[model samples]
Target: MKTFSAKAEEVEHDWYVVDAEGKALGRLASEIAFRLRGKHKPEYTPHVDTGDYIVVVNAEKIGVTGNKEKDKMYHRHTGYIGSLKSVPLGKLRETHPERIIETAVKGMLPKNTLGRNMYKKMKVFVGPEHTHQAQQPKTLDI
Candidate 1:
């Protein structure tokens, strides 16, 4: 049996839509990350970008279990002295719902260049309207 190592040109990508309403944030992210990396495909290759484009809708309604909304912290630094900033999940959700999902999904991906390319394939929108309907994205249940 020949071991499969897929090349970029041979990788076929698809578009998928995921409704985030009432979905657990972490679980949703993990699944999306998996699909984004093409791990669900038989021809998956670790070093190539074999992921699909994921369009996430209803991001504002994504749920967090327990007291995570109040206790969860998102931190960022500006590469300056004492430039750290932190925000609670509740505040982030209100101000930037797409960012909440983006951050979660990004954290689930590999921390490397390939991960960055896969991250670009992910698109998150606050409401139900998305601009990628022309691609006929299949509805994904997560």
Candidate 2:
């Protein structure tokens, strides 16, 4: 018996589409994260980029339980002093709904170069329509 390690050139990437309408925010993010990391595949290799492209549609319709829309806050800071700023989920959704899913999935992925590479393959759309129809991505149920 021998252990198999996947190589970058040997890995195959596929495109998948997921509808976020009526789906729990956290659950959807986790599933997308898994697919992005290729953890569900048999040839998953931690050091290689084995993930597939995931197109997330209807990002504006994603759901969050309780009062998260108001309670959840996104924060950022400038290099200077007293430059911290925060935005609530509700405000963020109104301004950039796509960012909600992007931030969630980003938090679930590894904080490194490989993670950023995989994250680039994840496409998010505010509406049901996407521009990747040419890729013929299969529907991914979550």
Q: Whose TM-score is greatest here? A: 2
**Candidate 1 positional error at 123, Å:** 0.3
Residue 125 error, candidate 2, Å: 0.5
Could you tell me the lDDT of residue 55 within candidate 2? 99
TM-score of each: 0.97, 0.98
lDDT of 2 by residue, 33-94 (tens): 99999999999999999999999999999999999999999998997899999999999999
The candidate that wins on lDDT is 2
Clashes by residue pair, model 2: none
* Steric overlap count per candidate: 0, 0
Judge candidate 2 at residue 110 and give its lDDT: 96
